[model samples]
Target: MSAIACASLSALVAPSLCRALPALAVAPRLLTAFPTATRQPAALSRRMVTSASLTPTIEDILVEDHRQFGEIMRRYNLATEKAEKKAALAELIRQVAVHSVGEEKILYPILEKIAIKGDAKAVIARERQEHKQVRDMLYDLLDRNLPVGDPLFERDVEAMYKYLAAHCAGEEVSDCPEMARFFPESARREFGKRFLAVKKLAEDQVAEEILDMESKINL
Candidate 1:
């Protein structure tokens, strides 16, 4: 009889055995769901490593950053402690600022050039407006210096999150993919490198500002 049938029979004939029967029935499914790991030959593993090390394109970099930013926001939302939430919020601010600036400085200019002429100005303008709204909200949050748990702070953070989520969705759906089509693979890779460099520079600037603030506090 099938394991499920056995389980049903056990339930009918022996209630105490029914629970154990279900476990027996589920065991094979659990094993199938998660196969046991096995060591591969060293040479095969090394080959796999080489294959995995291939460089990512511009789209890959942007998409990965979006994913990371989403994760930071998630961490901020899930953080129960004030200190933990503050830290997560600060990191999220830095990342959002850097990512927006990098796109504006490096990515958007290329996009503008490659974009269809009639729509280019309008698209770039709209994206810039969205970025401006986010930055304005961020500045307001920073200026308040309120505890993360404060009602005002929570409200502003939620607003910022909603705006950012919408902006990211638009870029992922329309902007990045359209811009990517205009560039050759080699040029796209180069753009990716430039994007990272610009983002790093922006992050450094934010770090310096943070250090300046902390130093003032210590003084």
Candidate 2:
């Protein structure tokens, strides 16, 4: 299955929705295992090196990240334990922040250059605005360290999901396909490598910030 199609299916069976179905007993375990099979860029690179023929494209990397984010969100929403919820939320924020930064720095710039200049600029601007909104929500969630059951926490989580889902839909339907048309096969693979590097840097920075915050809270 295509990465995008897999992600869409995973999102449908996410804990929140699956809980209402007859398969609820197995859903959690299935959902938990689903993320383990996702393709990370490092792993993809290694496979490509071994095969020397099948390289992942930039869209593949992005779609994989989106799936990871969706799975993390599902974990957060379904987590009954405080620690589980906290970990899920932290990872969700980290992934979303990393993906947004990578897109803005790497993908959107390439899109702007290759696409019709005016239209690309407008699209990038709108996407950036959405990213800003998501970042603000994430910062508030991280800064407060509120209990998962808190009303404010639930509200913010819902809001974050709504914005993120909309943004993902837009990208999958419009931006990614359009951008893919402009890049050659080799360039797309190279871009995937760069995107993964940027994502790792972003994830490390966010992890450090989270650790620092926790240290201060403990003090």
Candidate 3:
């Protein structure tokens, strides 16, 4: 049985389980230098944390991402215009797709370097499975070939919203916060920096590919 995406999102290892379980946050050590990313336009980089940020931990970054995901979904649901809805859904897919991978590749694996409980590894396994489900849903969203105005397009987008809402909620509650329980503050910050780098790298490459794919999506 797979735990659904918190974005596992976070609940699998709550504070009560902290002492008994292991940590799953990103960052094994302080990164001597922040990773480089090509600069992006202000509009495209709406929710990203910059290198200039004085002090935001990785938890803050992930939480903010969850919030952004929700907001994009709401925008998609509320949008009356085709263009409006299309943009919102495209952004939602891009953010969730990338963030999920970031956690898998950067966030959780670093924590594996430390001594972790069997349950924690199990939680990570579930999260990885959840990520697979999410990826499948995203591909389904695209493969449906439904344009913004089609009723079926609305149906699929709504379905994605519900799934992601559950995923984000679980992560914010348990997965995100427990990251701080075991790791030092520097590790958290380093993870944030690394995650942001991933986001920046995706800006032109992944986001554009998704936008182009969704625009042409029509049954």
**Best candidate, lDDT:** 2
lDDT of 3 at 145: 72
User: What is the full ranking by lDDT, best candidate first?
Assistant: 2, 3, 1
TM-score of 1: 0.68
Candidate 3 segments whose C-alpha is farther than 4 A from its true place: 1-55, 204-212
lDDT of 3 by residue, 193-217 (tens): 6766656654554565566656665
In candidate 1, which residue ranges exceed 4 Å CA deviation? 1-54, 210-219
Residue pairs with clashing backbones, model 1: none
The models' CA-based lDDT, in order, is 0.56, 0.57, 0.56
Q: Which residue pairs in model 3 clash with each other?
A: 5-167, 6-9, 6-167, 8-127, 9-171, 10-174, 10-175, 11-175, 145-218
33 Cα displacement, candidate 2 (Å):
38
RMSD after CA superposition, every candidate: 22.8, 13.6, 12.8
Error of 2 at 148 (Å): 1.4
